[model samples]
Target: MDRAQRLAYNQPTWLDTVAAWLLALLWILPLAYAVWTAFHPTEYSTRFTLLAPLTLDNFSRAWEAAPFARYFLNTALLVAMILAVQLVLATLAAYAFARYEFRGKNVAFALVLVQLMIMPDILLVENYKTMSQLGLVDTLVAIGLPYFASAFAIFLLRQTFLGIPKELDEAARVEGATAMQTLWRVYVPLARPVYTAFALVSVSFHWNNFLWPLIVTNSVKARPLTVGLQVFSSVDQGVDWSIITAATLMTSAPLLIGFLLFQRQFVQSFMRAGIK
Candidate 1:
């Protein structure tokens, strides 16, 4: 190559590199601080001395201070229940939108799409009233009831279903497959990546959900880890950074570990779903 071309090629992209590193640092600073505070003594929480003493007492105390085991169970059940209902409802709705031609089909889809513009938090009052009337207040079922039908999930799946070739559906039908069978064998299998991506998004959102859960649940019986952490941190004894950070880490550990372990699959699923 010419000298000028070589010089141009060898020039460093310092700006982009610095910008990326800066953003990454900003993103991880809270997590890094949490780890630092959670592991060290309370006196060192605001200090960054490298030789600070580390202890596991905070974790022990935090665990003993709350019903974390029950909280964990409640969060797990909530995420699973919401995900199952969302998948089933979204799949059925998406299938209808994708394959069926009916009266008011476009209008119905328009209504579904309209939900995407509306924030779920905006309907909290109505949702609370509905739950109250149903006598499901202060229960896990109440927390998950409003989210059983996810517009975003339905929209994503419907778009994916639309991208699927009609030939496969016809082939399945020619082989005597019913509509449900065709959907199961042809569409569902092909849409696995989309499902995975949606599952990840749904689980992460609901796992970290706080406001709705706080409003709907009045006791530890239905409170998720997030609410439990808040309650544990705001104690009458006053906030101790060490104990609070330790509890924060404990509550967030599952999601962090899960993301670290399945990050590759998560990215790949999103890529495939995006392509479809």
Candidate 2:
């Protein structure tokens, strides 16, 4: 290409780069401030100064002020339970949708896809009513039962399954493997990358979910870290920025550390999952 055409293309590329950086900075500003305020004293929260003293007192106070240990355990259990069930259900459902040609299969798959367009929050009232009827209200099961069957997970896994070659499935069956055995030894093993990617997304989402958990859980026993953080930040006296920021950091530290440690694998999984 001539210099003039090359310059024209490079100009838009440069502009896109600048715009991306600007958006990234805007996104990171609040997190940067939270890190700053969490480590510094209350007086330095709003006032930015290089010589401000750092301390761990805010974290200690926040920890002592709430049942964060319980909240952490609750959140961990909730995420683990949801992820486990989702993986099992999604794997089975996706395999059926991808490989089986049963009656009404198209209609059933269409209904599943419909859920991708509907918002989960819109079903909160119905879910709550069902939970009440089941006598599971105000329990961790109630908070998680509504989300055990994830439409997105089913869809992603189905797409990944569909991309797998039929030769592998036939080979497994030719070796006298039952249908379930073929699925277990062939499809499930091949879809590991997609499974990992979906697990990360699921864990991150449930860890940060606040509204439904807040509504379903009434006490500290079932309250996740998000709700606990909310209660800790809202007291009768006033908002304590330093303590709140420290608590926020403490609550988010696990996810942050996990992402930082596995970001390369995370990106690779997503890329492989997206190939189909």
Candidate 3:
């Protein structure tokens, strides 16, 4: 290695190793506790013993206590709709900004960048007012509408598109391919890693989104799992740690299982995307 590289990337010291282990323990402690509580009887929740009996009754009780099936359906639909719309819009917008020259293009891109700086939570009241005016409140569409246009996705895709070679675009045009066809068959295929990376972020964010969905939706038909879980854990239902933890696990299991299954692909997508 070069002198600069050797100096800048020294091996971890003993203290660094200790700190890393401690942080990992801190992160896993809660999940471990939740797993233990969810599988064991309520009485054994606080007491950790090797002889503690395991049961699926907690999961059953949690399921019966709420309309989780509807919540799951609603959550699934909401996530899919948002992801689909965001991908379409982001792709078109990114292509235009990256490949075409137009009046005030820099100013328009600056506005999009401004959106990246503004936090979505800051617009909650305004968003609610708009949704209310459109009579979209209390519907799945209302929850997904505000997120249909994603600035981050546009920026990411645009950067990826810009990094692609112009020779590819010229070659496709030489073959008599139109603009849309070139985008579909050339740029889109080349940017698959970036799309995969962005899709992961969008899906995870929308899946766990709570405050906005909770504010916009009331009925079970529109409520996502996070909102449903909150209502399930409310005092009106009485506290049962085992059941609550089980419900938590149930709601989080899809994300956890998805990660476990796609961990390699996820890492590879991000790495390739960053390189592009």
Clashing pairs in 1: none
Report how far residue 171 has shifted in candidate 2, in Å: 0.9
The estimated TM-scores of all candidates read 0.94, 0.94, 0.94
lDDT of 1: 0.93
lDDT of 3 by residue, 54-98 (tens): 999999999998999999999999999999999999999999999
**RMSD (Cα, Å) of model 1:** 3.3
Residue range 1-276, candidate 2, lDDT tens digits: 665786887755566689999999998999999999999999999999899999999999999999999999999999999999999999999999999999999999999999989998998898888999999987889889988999999999999899999999889878999999999888998999999999989999999999999888789989999999886656999899999999999999999999999999999998988843
Q: Model 2: runs farther than 4 Å from truth?
A: 1-12
Overall lDDT per candidate, in order of appearance: 0.93, 0.92, 0.93
Cand. 3 TM to true fold: 0.94
Q: After superposition, how far is residue 224 of candidate 3 from its true place, in Å?
A: 0.5
